[model samples]
Target: MTQSKEIKKPSSGLAARIFRQQMFIPLAALFLLALFNFIMDPSFYRISFDYNSVGNPVLSGNIISILDAGSELAILAIGMTLVTAATGGQDISVGAAIAISGSVVLRVLCGTNSRPDTLQAPIFVAILVSCVVAMLFGAFNGMLVAYFRIQPMVATLILFTAGRSIAAWINNNELPIISDPSFGVFGGFIPGIPIPTPIFIAAGCMIVIALVLRFTNLGLYVQSVGINESSSRLNGLNPAFIKFLTFVVLGLCVAVAGLIKVSRFSSINYSVVAKDIEMDAILAVALGGNALSGGKFNMKASIIGAYVIQFLATTLYKFKVQSTALPAYKAVVVILLVVLSAPKVREYLARIGKQIRQKTHVKEAG
Candidate 1:
């Protein structure tokens, strides 16, 4: 009986530890969703190799497709994670910002001609200029929020309303189609690579950010500012500078996402490019077990959350759900996940755990 009780204690403790993990909730949801998909169709997660129109090898399947599609959101989520960590606020203008950047890329490419065949000197210039434009836009939001002490949502709302129009104006209200084949490599696949290039781009961004966070004091400083700006300042950290820097990083991410979006179709539609992505980016951050109120963050969890969102959307469409109705269904699931990850729910679970342990101890003693 004593041996049995000891064994049960270890198992219970292990279960409790697993449940306490920050990534546990999102991981569990992803697992359950994957299971559901498998049950619905045994081949849902299967991957296969195929040749593209250009005779290049490519990975094709639902699972690979989901990851490929989620790349843009995943990249945006990393920036959103940093911004949320430093400012305790989410950016509502990321979608608009993406539009502006995408337009900049095309506007520069189309300079001197509507469609250029070869990758000219102008493409590189366009990429640089677009990234700068995005950074400036981000700085504007930072100034409003940090310098003027405006709320992030309200501050970014200005760009949210006019960013698309600004993008349209940049391109003279023309939807430019890029005629370069090499440009598609960023969004599609390279000759020797079977996986999508956006996956590599997203992975590279994550790696760079991960290394920065791991090797430097930026992570600590950002968390300090987010947790308490006064305390951060008193500790000799520049809270305002940290906040501004975070927005700039987000702007860079916006440029990358925009470039990928344009490369995907080799075209830009100012009206619909990157529409409503801010919602997905915020949802990814929240579902990743990070607090919306700010402070500490986990980038890996957020990336997983992004993929989960894409998977959910893909699954919904597989079930014959209409495009318009997809948002409603996804929202319902997101709300439930967010509520389950709430601090109150976690505290209650902790309380119940203690009670259960106490009951088990009493039983063993008796």
Candidate 2:
């Protein structure tokens, strides 16, 4: 019995260490969600291939839907994580920014017509134009926050309020629809591919960011600036530029997400496109155990949190939760997650774990 107890100690200690890691919160949330769905209905984990209307084999099921639909949110969460870490605040304008970016893509594709028989510009050209437009808008917000010293949420609020209106004004209050099937490939599945295109796009973005983080000092600079801007500046880092850079990077992310959104429908809805997604993106950051007030962050955790959120939504839908009531249900879960992830609560839990471990050792000795 003593030998068995000693052998189990190392594994138990390792698990406790893992539980104390920043990634633990999001991972635990994912596990719980998966377990809940498995308990409620094992079919929720089912994945099968089927041909679409275009005769392309594509994956289907609740799990696939979560990955497919959550792509945009995951992309946005990457940028949101950086912006939150650097600015110590959330950007409330991302949804509106997405609208503006999507509008730009349609405007470039449709040219002077509301419904175009053919694309006026190549798909790549439209995407590039939208990317520039989104980056410019991101720079504008960064200027206010970094240079003008405005609060991040307040600075972004300017665009949040008028972005949809600006999106409408971009195409003269017209809804532009692209008739090209090639454009749909960005949001849908490619020929002979069993997975959604957005998933690939999101994966590409993840790869790029991963490479950047691996090869550059961007992560270190962001964390240093976030932890202490004054100290970072004294250490030769340009705090202002770092902050501005994060927002610009976020804008680039917004452009990608907007492309997926408009491509999903092959059209733009000025007011309805990507609406209220900013809140979800922020929630993703929080759910990943990243501090709302800024410091360190886990990009992978935030991405996972994005998918977890999509999972939660899918679960609710499966249960026939009304769309209108979805936000309220999500809010309750958010509140619980936030409370449990709190530092005070974690410390308390750690204390209880230590005591339990000590008691176990005492009983074994006796």
Candidate 3:
């Protein structure tokens, strides 16, 4: 019996360690969501091979839809995680920035025509131009926050308010449609590919960021600056540049997401494209168990949290919830998650756990 008790101790300790990890919350949430869906409807887990309109074989079902739909949010969450880590605040302008970027892509592709029979430039060129434009705007916001010491939210609000207008002006308030079939491949499925193109794009972005973090000191610098700017400066780190760089990185993410958005429709709607997506991205960061106030962060957790949010949204839609009411329902869940993830709440739970463990030890002794 004593040998069995000793053997169980290591496993229990490992479980507790995992429970206390930053990834635990998002992983638990994902498990709960999966379990709930399984209980409510086993069909939700079903995946089947199907042909799309273009006669390409594709996977279909709730899980695939969640992964496909979550791609953009996941990409955005990667950037948002870095920004939140460095600036200690969220960027509110990403959705609007996407509009501007998508508009630029259309403008370059159409080349003064609202409806183009053929692309004026290569798709890659249009994407490159839009990427540059997005980075410039990101720099603008970064300057305000990093150089002038403005709050991140307030600095980004400037672009959020006028970015759509700027996007409209880029193409003279015209909505251009691309007739080229190749453009659609970015948002849809490629020839002979079963998975959605957006999934590949998101995966590529994840790989790039992971490599950057692995090969460079960018992650450590961002964390150091975020935790204490003054101390970081003393340690020879440039807090302002680190903060500025994060916003620029986020801009790159916005441009990629915008590309996916416009390619999906092969056009742009100035007012409606990517609307309120910034909020979802911010919520993803929060749900990852990362501190909004800034410090250490877990990029993997934020990415998983993005999928969890998409999972919840898809589940609600499955139940036929009204589109307008989705935000309210999400808001309630967000409140619960945020409160449970609070530091004080975690501390209280830990104290209770310790007490329980002590009592169990005493019982064993008796």
Candidate number with greatest lDDT: 2
Per-model C-alpha lDDT, please?
0.90, 0.93, 0.93
Candidate 1: where are CA atoms >4 Å away?
1-7, 116-120, 352-366
lDDT of model 3 at residue 250? 96
By descending lDDT, how would the candidates be arranged? 2, 3, 1
User: What ranges in model 2 sit over 4 Å off?
Assistant: 1-12, 356-366
Report the C-alpha lDDT of model 2 over 135-235, residue by residue, as the tens digit.
99999999999999999999999999999999999999988888889999999988999999999999999999999999999999999999999999999
Over the full model, what C-alpha lDDT does candidate 2 score relative to the true structure?
0.93
Worst 10 residues of 3 by lDDT: 1-10
Residues 1-366, model 3: lDDT tens digits: 333434478876777689788999999999999999999999999999999887999988888888888999999999999999999998999999999999999999999889989989999999999999999999999999999999999999999999999999998998898989999999999999898899899999999999999999999999998999999999999999999999999999999999999999999999999999999999999999999888788899999999999999999999999978999999998998888888898799989866777677787789
lDDT of 1 by residue, 104-162 (tens): 88878777555766644566788899899999999999988889989999999999999
Q: Cα lDDT for residue 236, model 1? A: 93
Measured by TM-score, how close is model 3 to the native structure? 0.95
